[model samples]
Target: MKVSFLIDNALREAVVNSCIGILLKAMDIECKLDNYNFFYSPSGFDFFDRTRENIDLTLFPSYNVNRTPEQLSRAIRTNSMMVATHAEQIINSALYKEKLNTSAKSKYSKQITSHFVWGPFFAELLMTHSSIPADKIYITGNPKLQVSTRLNTSTPNLSPSKSVLIVSDFSLGDMDDERWSQFKKRYKANYNTPIHRHYYEARRKLVNWVLTASERYPNIHFKMRIHPGEDRAAYELLKGTNNISLVGDRDFIEDVLDSGLVFSYSSTSLFEVLVMDKQVFNLDLHDLPEERKGEYFELFEWVNKSQFMDILRNYDEGKVFYPSSGRKKLLEKYMYGGNQKAVLRNAIAIKDVLENRIAQYGFSDFLVHYRNLCLSLVKDKAVKAGIWFNKELGLQNYISTLANRRKEADLNNPVRLNPNKIESAYKIASGIVTESEIEILKNNLYEIRKEKDGIYIDF
Candidate 1:
């Protein structure tokens, strides 16, 4: 059977979904997955349409950026079935809502015959907001379940008791609570203006917390693994600490499997950690929204205050909380709708809905178990063509340019924006903003007004 998958962009979060495409091929279905930015303009539709036919199925996960299932469905004329996951991730952002609404208005919404949601929350949200039917809801566990590759990477040689893993919180570049507060006072006293966005907002402070926890507890060593899409600067800053080690590799499930405990700040990684049935901990910070506050607090048996001393004092001896034995049954009811391999199950379900009999299928015929293989092999040429980018290029400034490459390749460099270099480049340009070098740029420079002839560098 022929199948294709589209993830729009290759951000770390989206790459996590590549397992579905891989699994399809393993089941002996032909598949193609690519990072095509289908939302740029109308002309972009052809790239997606060309791969639609002569295939048994199409999987479109990670469409959070701009494209909608409706838009792509109408462009492709295929008798092959279509199955989509992560339907809820699309509307979770304020930015995506605008794009989704626009696409829905243009007749794209009506064309999508089948789409699966992340969980009950998203399933309910979509039905309430759109004309979609109830049968469309399928609790397909994410392909991330297949993320056990890391577990295989380390085996009898690695002792789980000797290692502990900490997955840091999700962060916006401008959302540092401490940095934003300081920037506000500095801005108001000097410019008499209030700062709107948080400045110095990387996950740097959490590294300190990690160090403190490590120092306090000597029994189990600590390993730090930041989100894959995150830049190297966040990890580099922590490198100076003697005790902590950085794991920047892309594999997620395997890394967690090798470790005994995981500490996260409201990351979806918690789901995978639970899937592994390992001890999980949650850290509390101040920048997140209220409703989201402590949402995952109940999930972990372990919880800690944000204060360094308090965490250091209590963390080592703290006991981890586990969801009840019945918890998995409860979560699976809403999360997986009984089928853990939701993508595969959803395709089978779709075939059942369209036809009648349900036949057994497998990915072995189409996909080879090159378990030792790296995705870079299949993705390298595309990376050169604008698919994936690495954070290793510039350690100091990885946050600024780590994943920005339209395609994945090593040749790309961060467009340097040093103050002196900018001044020279702008002096010769026609309408550039290099008026003065002595400028106090806020986090969100575009939001600030120029009092004098100060130059604004929009990043």
Candidate 2:
């Protein structure tokens, strides 16, 4: 049996999925997994020399599959049993009404064999809104948050020195056409303000506050981890302060765990810190719409720039107040099982499906797999030929036009992963998991394999 995890965002999902990959491998399943970019993108053919045609099961990166037609069409065309496993777990009523409704009512959702959700909240949304069968909804916690407990204890995640980490969650940035269209509608409805103006206005204020704070406290180091959606170059001017460093490419989980103090404008990542019983601030520089506050308001300490500065001053002086004891209950209420063995739960669910797997027309699928393998070789050759011709011959103007024919920019997610990285992540996660679970996989550690044979792909 073959399974493919079509990852949407590599940085966020890859590590946790690595945990899942190992579990599936232990089940004696041949798993093909990577960023959906490499699995579906035109340039992806470069890294892949063979394809596993007609996969037994394909787990898409997010439930928002309707947002990307190209990927959706390709996924439907290629896979046998499709599962909608979400990467984005933070869902509010407004967000669900605006974004997820399209996915819920989508034909793709109807075709999906299983719909995996982060919590009961998401499961209820799919059940109520999509009218999907109750049996189909799998309430798996967000994959990343699943491994949070193990990752939290990973000593390397702890900082060597005290540093302040400001998670910048600005709203304006590159978006898919569907989301962009929605943003336009929201912009029109809100009289020219962006869809999430509160995030924009507040994060902007927080940025200025940090710039001044970084100077005022030169001895303290501050790292502004910019939002993945926001353009990093937009904050180039803020990089002048030596005490503050604007970053985009580091591991957010590790950084969050390492930081002495953590703050964000409106990101849900702060909850990961809260899980470790650490203090994190949600800087509400601008008043957030009551509807947009969502369930996290009770778990996180919502404060403004000035209030944050006062807290920071206290933090620097070695005094800080942690989140309330009641936050544990709120976290549990919102996070379903509140950080249980989600990776194991996901692995077990996929395993059960595979164990009772239906027989596909075996011979035809064998032929199809080989055919796809051959076609992958052809695609790889063609991609290499194009690259050689463009770079070697210096024919940019012509190649640019051909490249524009493919959605290269859209396929190019900010973070990319390779087998070595995935393997390394697998090893790291293996170490962090419980000893008994490690014993289960110890015999099969070498069994973990991927569909394609490339180190990495750069689109």
Candidate 3:
């Protein structure tokens, strides 16, 4: 048996996928972990679909609930049992349901054979709202959270904690005029409330507040971590300030571990910080009337810029403490992160499907698969020709986000695939998979394989 994984954010998924690959190898099953672009590419061309081409199962991280026909079409083309695990777990309950409602509820949800969830919170959401069967959802704790905890323990001697880490999850209206125009028009047509509009206004207010605060207090060091896809040109003012420094690209845990106080709004990273038992202040940037905040905002004692400064003054006087009880309760409710390692639990679930212990209900039949394959072959020639022409003309920037998903995808995601870092995480072994059996194969591309002495690249 052979299994494959679709790895998007390499920094976070690399270790988890590698560990799963090793576990499957122990079960005498082959595994391949490939980037989304690389996995689907045919002979180094664009818009091709060769996923699970010669493999049994493919674990695609299906982050969004609503998928277009074009999106679902590729899954049909996989020609193998496909499993889905939502990479970005929900933060905003209101927006999450909307994102889940489209074709996912009507088609894509049932098409997937297995759905790995973080816990009951998401499981219930999928079953109730997305038309996914209860049996299909596996409540494995998030692999990212599990790997994050392991990374935290293995390497603790990081830089001294900074005064404050402002983690931004805001996608502002500050992109190139064309993209921003499209974004606004889409939101205006679809949303009931002006969701993006409110976020933009609040974002400017918060940024200005932070800039003002940075100048006011020279002693308190401030660090800003923005999403990887964001245009950095918007943040050029920070270079002039002595106290404020923009964070470099690194794992989310590394930034969190080095920060004394956490401040964020509208990001799932808040859950990650809570899992680490760090006390985080919810930055109240909701400036609109009847604003619907995420479920997480209720957990923190939110404050404005002045209140944030007061808290910092209190922190300097040794009056701050981590919230252990809050962390425990929230983790239980959302993560289902019981004592057992999440990575192992997730691997076992995948292994069960590979061994035929559990059966999947794929939406497509054999005839549908054959038709899709024919369409893809015909489609690829045109895409390949267009790509060749576009590159020659140096018109790469015009490509939409879909094709922009290649290695250099500017999704504002900072974490990247690094073989050495993955080995470090595995060397700190999560029990079932030992350190000796797993090695990251770094020939031309990073592929983690399990063997005593050989790197398996036969696929």
Rank list by TM-score: 2, 3, 1
Highest-TM-score candidate:
2
Q: Per-residue lDDT for 1-459 in model 3, tens only?
A: 877777676655666787777766765788766655432221333335345365667787753433223334455555456777788666455445444454346445555677777877777677666777665666767766766665556566376544678888667535445665675454322434556666676677777878887776667778888776665665777777888888747666778777777888766677777776677777777754343455545565678777877887777566765866856585677776542356666766676556653333454544444665566666566455556656676555323223445534433445544455456545544543544333322112222232222111111
Q: What shift in Å separates residue 450 of candidate 1 from its native position after superposition? A: 60
Residue range with the least summed lDDT across 10 consecutive positions in model 3: 450-459
Which of the numbered candidates is closest to the native, going by highest lDDT?
A: 2
Q: Tell me which of candidates 1 and 2 scores higher on lDDT.
A: 2
Q: Candidate 1 — worst ten consecutive residues by lDDT sum? A: 448-457
Candidate with more favorable, higher TM-score: 2 or 3: 2
User: What's the TM-score of each model vs. the native?
Assistant: 0.57, 0.78, 0.77
lDDT of 2 by residue, 106-222 (tens): 454555667667667666666676666566666666557757667776665455665888887675434444665677565322223344555555656776788878777777789
Q: Which stretches of candidate 3 lie over 4 Å from their true place?
A: 37-44, 47-52, 63-78, 91-106, 161-163, 175-190, 288-292, 317-320, 338-340, 357-380, 383-459
